[model samples]
Target: MKVAIASDGGNVAQHFGKCQEYAVFDVVDGRSENFSYIPNPGHQPGFLPKYLKGLNVDCIIAGGMGQKALNLFAENNIQPIVGISGEVKQVMEDYINGKLTSGASLCTHPDGQHHDCDGHC
Candidate 1:
């Protein structure tokens, strides 16, 4: 399976749409195989979901994502795991080891302003 973690530098970005890049990791037999970073294509409505789907992304891991993007990902048959933070490598490892859990973080807007994001993830 392939997992995409919305990231900035190496950490999971606070908000999915405003994230700088994506760390795409491939896993097989429940073990991670490899990873690559991809720049954010753009944050226009449903564009990202489609773009990621084209890359055959199976799941998305992020700190937060609004309702629209989550719905689009669902529509595209891509599972989304939100409320994740910390560096991408650790997050991925935790997930692979079945230690990561989704928190209650949800971004209502792309700007990441005027929203309560602190510790929400």
Candidate 2:
């Protein structure tokens, strides 16, 4: 399976729309096999979903995302997992180990307010 994690400077970006890049990880048999970074094309309405689809992304992992963006991913046959945080590598590792789980989206407002309480992003 191939998953893309919204990233910024090697860590999970808190807001999907503002992520600097995507840390794409390819997993086989629960083992990560490859990793790469694709700089974000841009975050215009109705753009990222299609862009990620073109890359054949199966899923997207992020700390937070707006509902519309999440729905767009679903429409494109790409799963969106929100409320993930921390270094990109460790986040991917936890996912492979089945230790990561989606929680309430961190950026509920999506109006650019109070999303990064921890200031990691």
Candidate 3:
């Protein structure tokens, strides 16, 4: 499976749409391999899910995600795992070990406006 983690400066970005890039890993038999980074193309409504899907990403990990994005990912057959935080390497380890699980969305946009949260989300 291919997993992508929304990242900024080697850590998980708070908001997936606003992230600087993605840390992508190809996993086989519960082992992560062939890591790479993909720059964020830009954040437009319903764009990212399609973009990652095009790249054959099977799953996405992020600190937060909007409701619409979550739905879009589902439609694209990409698993969206949100409410994650911390460094990318550590997060990857947890995911490979089956210790990672999603929690509540950290997104604070009730009105659906994309605003900078200064990495606090």
Candidate 4:
């Protein structure tokens, strides 16, 4: 299976849409195959889902994602694993080791600011 992880430098981005790049990792039989980094195409409504789907990503791992983004991913048959934060390599390794477990989102859009966070306060 192929996994796309939302990343910024060495850590998981706080927001999926604002991530600088995506580290695409391919896993076969519980072993990681190869990995590559792709620049974020764009952060438009429903755009990310299409972009990731085009890459044949089976799942998306990220620090946080809003409900709309989650819905879009579901619509495209892409599973999202949110509330994760750490180095891209570690995340991938955890996945390969069957230690990564997905839970609820860890972020909340305070003050109704749904958009334009852009990785900064």
Candidate 5:
């Protein structure tokens, strides 16, 4: 599976929309295949989903994200795991070892728009 971890420096980004980059890791049979850090292609509404989808990402791990972003991932069948923090490599290891479990969002949307919360888009 291909997992994308929202990153800021070396830790998990505080917010998905505001993340500086995404560390794309490819795992096959529980073994890492390749990894790369790609700068975010901008988070314009409805655009990032398409961009990420095109990259063939199967999952997205982040600290928090807007409901719309969650919906976007849902539409693409990409699992969205939020409320994650810590080193990117460790997070991936936890995930691979089945020790990683998601929790509620840790950050809030700054725009205060309709796409704010509600857990739905």
Candidate 6:
């Protein structure tokens, strides 16, 4: 499976659409490999889902995502793992070990703004 983690520097970005880049990984037999980074093309409504879909991404990991983007990912058959925050490598390890669990969506806006979470990401 191909996984894409919304990233900023070496850590997971707080918001999917506003992330600076994506850390893409190829996983096989519960192991992750072929890790690479892809620059965020830009944040446009409905654009990212299609873009990642075009890249053949099977899943997305992020700290938060708007409802519309989540729906778009669903329509594209991409599993979205939200409410994750940590170093990219550690997060990937957690996912590989099946220890990662999605929490309540940190973003409340359909437009991908960081308006919720009580200023605590």
The TM-score obtained by model 6 is: 0.88
What's model 4's TM-score? 0.90
Residue 71 displacement in candidate 1 (angstroms): 0.7
Residue-wise C-alpha lDDT for candidate 1, range 11-68, written one tens digit per residue: 9987787789999989888888878999998776678889999999999999887766
Cα TM-score per model: 0.85, 0.87, 0.90, 0.90, 0.87, 0.88
Tens digit per residue, CA lDDT, model 6, 22-113: 99998999899899999999887788899999999999999888677888999999999999999999999999999999997766566645
Top lDDT prediction, candidate number: 3
Which stretches of model 1 miss by more than 4 angstroms? 106-121
Q: Model 5: residues >4 Å from true position, as ranges?
A: 109-121
The residue pairs found clashing in candidate 6 are none
For 1-121, candidate 2 gives per-residue lDDT tens digits of 8899999999998888788999997989879887999998876777888898898889899988777777888899999888888999999999999998898787755565544432222
lDDT, candidate 2, equals 0.84
Q: How many backbone clashes does every candidate have?
A: 0, 0, 0, 0, 0, 0
Task: Judge candidate 4 against the unseen true structure and give its global Cα lDDT, from 0 to 1.
Answer: 0.84
Q: Distance (Å) between predicted and true CA of 5, model 2?
A: 0.2
Distance from true location, Cα of 2 in model 1, Å: 0.5
Mark the 10 consecutive residues where model 2 has the least summed lDDT. Answer: 112-121
